[model samples]
Target: MVVGAGLAGVRSVEALRAHGFGGAITLIGEEPHRPYDRPPLSKAVLLGEIDSTVVDSDLGALAVDHRPGVAAKGLRAGVLETTEGELAYDALVIATGASPIRLRGEGPQHVLRTIDDALGLRALLRQGRRVAVVGAGWIGAEVATAARRAGCEVTVVEAAECPLAAALGPVGAHTAPWYERAGIDLRTGAMVASVDLGGLTLVDGSTVEADVVVTGVGVRPSVDWLAGSGIELDDGVVTDEHLRTALPGVVAVGDCAAWWSRRYGRRLRVEHWDTALNSPEVAAATLLGGPGEGAVYDPVPYFWSEQFGHMVQYAGHHAGARLVMRGDPVGTRWSACWVTDGGTLAAVLAVNLPRDLMQGRRLIEGGQHLDVDRLADPAVALRDC
Candidate 1:
């Protein structure tokens, strides 16, 4: 039984069938619609450049019993309780995904977690509308982009001094000027004290009149349904290297699952689409191959975003790694690499430089040693290093 109708759940079903699993499969989804992509919701969908249909895909031939618009209430032992009925599964895969964190005292506060959210926000983003976006992370940045495109006066309110502080560190703040260049009011170190229909009130006793307010603080794993399931839960569902939970015959994957990565020697829970698409194959292999030969769920985490006229791509992890610049951050195209003291590549970020990310991802995944000088020199080919 697969619980979730999102990318991870659908991909898990496809992987299982491709691996020749002839057993009966049941896919349960809380959403009424079929599985669809989510990345475009913040980009093309919000800008009205494309509709939600762009992310829709047909999963009719998967030969699985797909139940849409049904909610899973709980899980205990081998029985799964849901809005439909209780289901007994020999093996269960949890792929419930994550939920976006919302703001308090919300009057017109919104989050871009579903198709309805994008559509609702898009409808309110008429020309001359004042849009206040709280949080300067990926979602906030993208929403600001779409709002500006719709001719709305956009103001981004960020609690941190820099954007993407938690993810990209100091380098992230460098992109802040792009907001000004695009005529957006980017307010840093600003805390939102209250949000009402009239507008937003900052901690500094200032008010920004806004027709619509969007919050993009962050998201938490959707694991509350498994509270009494006896499966370990930390930041996410704790799983072994094979994506198996503490409970036997139960496994977790995608955003809600944190598996120990043997390559990095740490537990990681990635909420990106790449993790959702890539991890399911390994999970399916492990589910069918059993304990003796199950494949390990270790992958190079990757993500990309389109904002402020720049295409950004990042791979691997940067925690505890030293930063190495490949090109000038002030330029239109540049790349940054994170190297460990032990000489192995840790992570890479490319801004408008696709080749750097394409090659740097391999080096990081392969744990390749870098000649710091060659990597710093943009003229040198990344493949040669």
Candidate 2:
């Protein structure tokens, strides 16, 4: 039985069947619709370039019982409690994903997590509408970009000193100017005091008028339903290297699962789409007692964001990495590399540089180290480095 029906849940089902799991597979989803690509919710979907119904894959002929529009109330020993009824399962996959952190305001605050959210926000993004976006993270950045594209006067508020502060360190401050170039009012070190239908109040007693307010602060794992289930929970459902919980017959994946990554030597809870896609394969293998049974769930986390007409791609984590620049950030195209103290490639953030992004992913995955001077030289080919 799979609990989420999101990317991880649906992928787990497909992987199970692919791995020759002949047992009865039941997929449960809280949303009425089947699993769909969520990253596009902030990009093409919001821009009306594509339909909101971005289903990841067709599940027809997959021979699985798909239950949508039902909420999982709780979990018990060897049983799943839902709004409909209890489901008995020999083994279960928990992939409930994560929920956006809502702002403390009375206004029409929005978050881009599901199809419904993107539709609602897109509808309100009329020309010249004052849209105040709180939190200058990836979601906020994308929303601001979309609003600007839709001719809305967008203002982005962030409590951090710079945008993407948590995700990108020294590179974040350099990237902040992109918002201004897109005609967005990028205000860092700004905190939201309150939000109303009229606008929002900042901690500095400044008032910004807005027709819509979107919060992209952060997200927490949707593990409240797992309460009393005896599953360990920190920031997310704690799992071993195999993406298995303390419970023997149960495993967790996706945003809700903080699996131990042997490569990073830490427990990571990645909310990106890549993690959702890859972890399920390992989880499925673990469930069927097959290829990935004893395999570790360490992966080089990859994520990309499209904003301000620049495609930003990042691979790997930047924890304690030595910052290195490949090109001028003030230019139209550049890339940044985060190297470990041991001189190995830890992560790479490239702006409109596809070659750097691709090669950086390979280098990080291969645990390759190169000469710092040569790596930073744009004229030097990445393969040569």
Best TM-score goes to which candidate? 2
Runs off by more than 4 Å, candidate 2: none
lDDT of 1 by residue, 304-338 (tens): 99998899999999999999888888888989889
Q: What is the lDDT for 215 in model 1?
A: 92
Residue-level error in angstroms, candidate 1, position 352: 0.9
Where in model 1 is the C-alpha error above 4 Å?
Answer: 53-58, 290-292
Please tell me which predicted candidate would have the highest lDDT against the true structure.
2
Clash tally, candidates in order: 0, 0
**TM-score for every candidate vs. truth?**
0.97, 0.98
The TM-score measured for candidate 2 stands at 0.98
| Cα error of candidate 1 at position 384, Å | 2.6
How far in Å is the alpha carbon of 230 misplaced in model 1?
A: 0.4
